[model samples]
Target: MLTRLAISGYRSLRDVRIVLGPLNVVTGANGSGKSSLYRALKLLADIAQGRIIQSLAAEGGLQSTLWAGPESFSRAMKTGRQSVQGTVRKSPVSLKLGFGGTDYGYAIDLGLPLPDSTSKFSSDPAIKSENLWTGEMMGRSNVFATRSGPGVRIRDDSGAWRLAYEHLSTFDSMMTHCSDPHDAVELLRLREQMRDWRFYDHLRTDRDAPARKPQVGTYTPVLAGDGADFGAAVQTIREIGASDEMDEAVADAFPGARIEVTSQGGMFELEMTQHGLLRPLKASELSDGTLRYLLLVAALLSPRPPALMVLNEPETSLHPDLLAPLARLIAQAAKRSQIVVVSHAAALVSALDAEPDSRQIFLEKRLGETVVLDGVPPSWTWPTR
Candidate 1:
């Protein structure tokens, strides 16, 4: 489980770090950088898939996503006594994201490449440095794998640093290329853990949404990010003998309602039997709020849980009354997977905060930088290029 998350030089998250728990609820007003934090986590997951550079490019490259404020805010600037203005940059353009767990930690630094007349992708951000270390915090002695620009090195079993690659791609991550099971066991393990990290932002509930249509029946342990296989996932959960929990979740949220996934001719369709209704309502016939809540249920009750699961604005389209049940479902899921919920709903936030081992992080914009209002920032050290 991730115990600490650190982000710097990304949107409003200019040097932000926070300790995490099994169940973490992040709440803040609009523009408090909740979305930025979510995207940062997603970017970290993308690194393990060898798509970090592509993800950054989709967001208009690094220059557009980098922190726009000054390198640092002075006392007077923060107090509004002085106008906020840019200062001479003391370092190169860098955006870093990292997370530390009890057994391992990983960080990656991205920076703008030097001006090159021959390269049309000069505007793209390059992977500057990366580090995979042991324990809860990174230190010089604990680091096992290191990447500096085009060079990659890993500590052998004899504890000697061995050069792994002389010319690694600037846009590629060591997590993808250097995770050899024989030479870099830690790297391979950490890389796979990161690859299994799941993220669910928007689960469409529109008329044309994929969840509304029947899909081929398959054993789906994990729900699709878009909830296209909602029925298959629910059926898988039921087949795994977790039908009691699934039924309880549905009834808790919708009172007398119970969820069902019917398979006809190898096509599965989701249905919900509610009180006072002679016929069960199909996924396409359900209300927007109801279908969305069911999608969240299927996602949380996934048979194959991830190492980390992140939900962004899950309260969207959810009724106030359903927030408590959703919160309860999320709390239960946290038992199997570390969850980070980014939401603005008071009911959901309060319900999640009351869960055991739950931690609440309230963010606020201070001097145009996102700052945690809960407590002191976690100790984090970024890899230097």
Candidate 2:
């Protein structure tokens, strides 16, 4: 489980660290940087997949995503004795993200690319440095693998440092370029775990949503990000996963409700049977809230849970009454996987707060920076360039 998450020079998250628990609930008002935190986590996942540079570019390049505030604020400025203003350069401009768990930690630093008129991709940001270390906190002595610019070094079994890659591309991550099961066991394991982190944001439940259409049935242990295979996912849970729990979740949310998957010509369609209903309601016939709730059920009840599961604004269209049931479902899922829920629903937040082992992180903006208001911030160290 991740014990800490750190982000710097990213949007409003200019130097923010969060302590995580088995189940974490991130809640704040609008413009409080809740979404920024969620996007930062997605960016970290993109880094592990060797897509960080491209992801940054897609978000309008590094300059657009970097913090727009001054490098540092003096006490006078913070106390309103002096107005906030930018000063001369002190430290190099960089964006950093990192996370640490009980056994290992990883961090990456990204900065503006050196001017290169000769190359068409000169505008791309360069990965300045990266570190993979053992233990919960990163330090010079604990680092086993380090990446500086295009080069990477890893500690050999004999305790001597050896070059792993002399010309690794700045656009690629060491997690993908130099991860070897034997040569870099920590990197390989961390990379695999990072890849297994699942995120679900605003699953579509429109009239023509993919989940509304029947899809070919297969043994699906994980639901697709778009929830297009929700039927197969729920059916898989009923067959191989916790069928009783799934049934209970459905009935808890909708009294006298039962879900079934019907197959016709190898395509599976979801059907929900409810009390006083003449016939079962198909996925397409269900309301947006109902369909979305079922999709959440399928996701939370996944047979093969990921190392981390993040849900963004899960209570978007959900009714207030359903929030309690949704909270119960989320609590149940937390037993199997580390879950982070970013929501604005008060009822949901209150419900989740009642669970033991759950932590609530309330974010607020101060001096245009995202700050945690309710919990103690975790200690974090960024790899220097």
Model 2 residue 70 lDDT? 92
lDDT of 1 by residue, 5-75 (tens): 99999999999999999999999999999999999999999999999999998998899999999999888
Give a tens-digit lDDT track for model 2, residues 1-385.
8989999999999989999989999999898998999999999889778888888889999999999999888899899999999988798889999988888888999987788888887767889999998888997688899999999999987879999999988788999989988889878998988999999999889999999999999999999989999999999999999999999999999999999999999999999999999999999999999999999999999999998999999999998889999999999999999999999999999999999899999999898878999666777767778
Evaluate all candidate structures by whole-model CA lDDT and list the values in order.
Answer: 0.92, 0.92
Q: Per-residue lDDT for 183 in model 2? A: 88
lDDT of 2: 0.92
Off by over 4 Å in 2: none
Clash pairs for candidate 1: none
- Per-residue lDDT, model 2, residue 353, is 97
